[model samples]
Target: MIDSHNHTSFSEDCKIPLNEMIESAISKGIKHYTITDHLDLDYQDKRFTFSLDHQARREAIFKAQAFYKPKINIYYGLECGVQPHIIKEAEAVIQKEQFDFVIASMHTTHKKDLYTQAFYHGLKPLEAYKAYINEFAWCCEVMNEFSVVGHLDIVKRYDLSLNEVNLEDVKDEICQLLKIIIEKGKGIEINTSGFNDIFQHAFPHPTILKWYKELGGSIITLGSDAHFPEKIAQHYEEALNQIESCGFENITVFKHMKPFEIPISDVRASLKLDIL
Candidate 1:
């Protein structure tokens, strides 16, 4: 199996060492693994910083790549926390680093951290969703360097309504965002982080997969979004089953900043996974 998005010590929030993560992936027999540490510039949180050291991170990845060459394939990737004002900074990092994959994610909507009450302070649930989507669309419009949008409907994860609101409520807004993504030749990531959450669903919800596919947006990568070792590739079988149900025959893999497709059936079989 290929897990295209992950984190390590390089990301401020995740303290796991690089070797530990690589060892875990090898144990799981993951065919491909990408370490995408966070690069959320000017993140509002004073207690945590999401800056990355390009040289240090690349050196570690290369060292591991050589020693683990026989065991598994490792790709250097980055998860960028994008906002309207920080778009240029995000683009600068992309230009400077030759990362295999870059996940443009909006951790903050209008410079406010989505996980905090500050993001949802005044607005009602649906209004909060619209505000987040609008800000995301604005970022996508200005930034043109990333590979795929990470957890496109991440707003639902923190909805004060306990997700009492469904995607249909913001369907039109999401449709416009998807179109912009498609127009930019970008795709989305199926983040499994939410599967274990209270909502028991995938990030952006798996149903959006079919919507993306129907809209001619075929590029997609499956990521566990795991910040630790044991959690790598968590709930993948369930995520893949949902993808198959969404009419996707293959999931995306990236190398040298280019996307390649491997049949979903082949991946499932290799990993000895069945529908959950």
Candidate 2:
């Protein structure tokens, strides 16, 4: 199986060394993996703010590649924060670097939009939810070069008490975003981190995946979004089952923006530790 989305110390939120993370994935029988470290330009939370030094990261990735390749395919990648204002800068960096893959994510609504109580203090629950979805749609329209859009409904990560957030209300907007993503030829990541959380399902929800499939969206990737070694390929079996149930026969992997497909049956077999 291929883990297309992941993080390491290169990302501010994760402090584990890259080698350790890679080794853990290897132990989990992941044949290929990508280190998609985070890069957000202007985050509201200063504590979770750190920009990737592309040069330094690239060097570290290369070093890891020398050690990990042949045993496992190590992809050097980045998870870039896509916001309306910083899209240009993000694009420039993507153009300059020959990354194996790029994941566009909407981590913040704006420079000041942190996931704090204060950020959602005044707005009604519905308004706040709409605002978040709107920003997500905007990000999708602005980011054209990403290989996959990570976690279509990631705002829920911050809103653990989202009793009022209705997928039905945002379905049309989310479908619109999916259309744009399909038009751009970028895949959507089935982030398994959601399975470990309160939602108990992957991002965008199963219904969203069904919609994407009905809309003729074909490209999809799977990720654990693992920050620690143990979480590598977490819930992969369930993730594959979810994709198959959504009518997906294949899942995609990337190498410098080019896609390769793996049959769901083969994925299931591999994930079962059945490979000879």
Highest-lDDT candidate: 1
lDDT, candidate 1, 1-276, per-residue tens? 888989999999898999999989988878799999999989887677889889999999999999999789999999999989888977987888889999999888867888775688888888888888888888888888888999887787776483877778887888788899999988899898878777566777766777788899899899999899988899888888888888889888888879999899888886784222
Off by over 4 Å in 1: 160-162, 273-276
Give one digit per residue, the lDDT tens place, for model 2 in 132-182: 768877877877778988887767677664435777887777788888888
Error of 1 at 91 (Å): 0.7
Query: lDDT at 197 for candidate 1?
Result: 76
For model 2, state the Cα shift of residue 3 in Å: 0.9
Q: Which ten residues in a row have the lowest lDDT in candidate 1?
A: 267-276
Quote each prediction's TM-score: 0.96, 0.94
lDDT by candidate, in order shown: 0.86, 0.82
- The TM-score leader among the candidates is 1
lDDT (Cα, 0-100) at 173 in candidate 2: 75
What's the CA error at residue 33 for candidate 2, in Å? 0.3
Candidate 2 displacement at residue 216 in angstroms: 1.0
Model 2 global lDDT (CA atoms, 0 to 1): 0.82
Question: Which sections of candidate 2 miss by over 4 Å?
Answer: 161-163, 274-276
